[model samples]
Target: AEEARQTTQFEPLPKSLFQPLPPFEDLPRPLSPSGASALIDEAKQAVIDTGSPVLDTEAEPGFAVMRGLALHKLLQMLPGIAEAERRDAAARYLKRAGAQWPETERDKALASVATILADSHFDQLFASNSRAEVAVMGRLEVKGKLRSISGKIDRLAVTSGKVSIVDYKTNRPAPATLADVPPAYVLQLALYRALLQPLYPEHEVSAALLFTEAPRLIELPPAVMDNALARLTGA
Candidate 1:
């Protein structure tokens, strides 16, 4: 419990892609009891059925969790990258990935997720005005009820005043440029953006895909955000 509390207090911060990014040295960790490092290591790296280590620097637990956070952030900011076209692209990429890059997919995903955790720009873009609140948010009306939106928005500042929806992507680059993005990711972000606009009612929204697998952050056009949100009106 103490460890968990410490984890909450020292939230993960992202590193910048430009220039030489700073290493995250300030994030705090609870110091374990004397001589407990061995036990902690055992707990962190327990083997799993999927043939993957639980907590690995090579495939760090922080990596996957950050990927999820990146997705949540993108959903709040730029979700267009994950809309129908992108989702379709993601699917096709995944298939091609399985055929041509199957052996490295897992490693690639780990790299993607890791970049998300260390994304300095990501942390800055999503940082809230309220210092007390680690989990910042906004809302939009979906149908009737006030819907909660804005979860870990990595590039909220980057929209340059456009409403952007974004999804976290772990897929690697492809010869087909669009296929580099995973489509289901876009769909997921689109739903979140559609939910937000009506609830917030003030902000002009847009969408994107923050590729954790690579350093690229891809934006989706406003038209895609509008069309996707329109489709959700009946639902």
Candidate 2:
């Protein structure tokens, strides 16, 4: 029996690892525009699987994410360059940024950006009146408590005493209408509008989602934004 017996020892995990998790309110985490929208959706039990990372700068982003980044970078730099030279500049930047991308992928990004530049309807977006990567930070009341939120607007345009907040979306098969738009996206723009509105109080503040893949722009109506704000702050 002694010869056949096998001795085994068990190791306990660290006590810290075994400790019960704290209440939701006790664990503090920074909220980004996407995270805030996710939280709002979770509260309403309307969450969907968008599969979007919290930040574009995440380590080891997938091919699609990398493509999106390349497109955003191109958009940011293109506005500063004269329209005639944007294509060449875009080609050079994409060649460097997407060195490993398939030739087709590189060509697609170039074409999409080219479409955006050629669309006269978007003239204001690339005009001198607009700015890219506008940083916004402020405290807003949420669920009867003040919470600090910060986000960078992809594009901010001031024209005719009106402010337009533009966020670029690389999602394919873009929403055909406001109703088809994701609630998280709407929430994101609402938060941006709330933060920027005070800074340009005298001007009418508007927001839109620019789907780069389709080169389509969808402006968010005031009523839609108001509804989203109500859901966000529990007003």
List the global CA lDDT of all models: 0.43, 0.82
The runs of at least 3 residues in candidate 2 whose Cα sits more than 4 Å from the true structure, single-residue gaps closed, are 1-30, 41-49, 53-61
Across 1-235, the per-residue lDDT of candidate 2 in tens digits comes to 5534532344556799988998767523435675576556544585553656222332345777888888888899898988889999999998999999888878989999999988899888878989999888888888787788878999999988799999998876666888888888888899999998888889999999998878789999988998888887888
Q: What are the TM-scores, per candidate, against the unseen true structure?
A: 0.36, 0.81
- Give the C-alpha miss distance for residue 26 in model 1, angstroms: 49
Q: Residue 228, candidate 2: how far off, in angstroms?
A: 0.8
Task: In candidate 2, list every pair of residues with a backbone clash.
Answer: none
Model 1: per-residue lDDT, tens digit, 166-192? 444443232134444433344445655
Off by over 4 Å in 1: 1-126, 129-165, 173-180, 230-235
The best candidate in terms of lDDT:
2
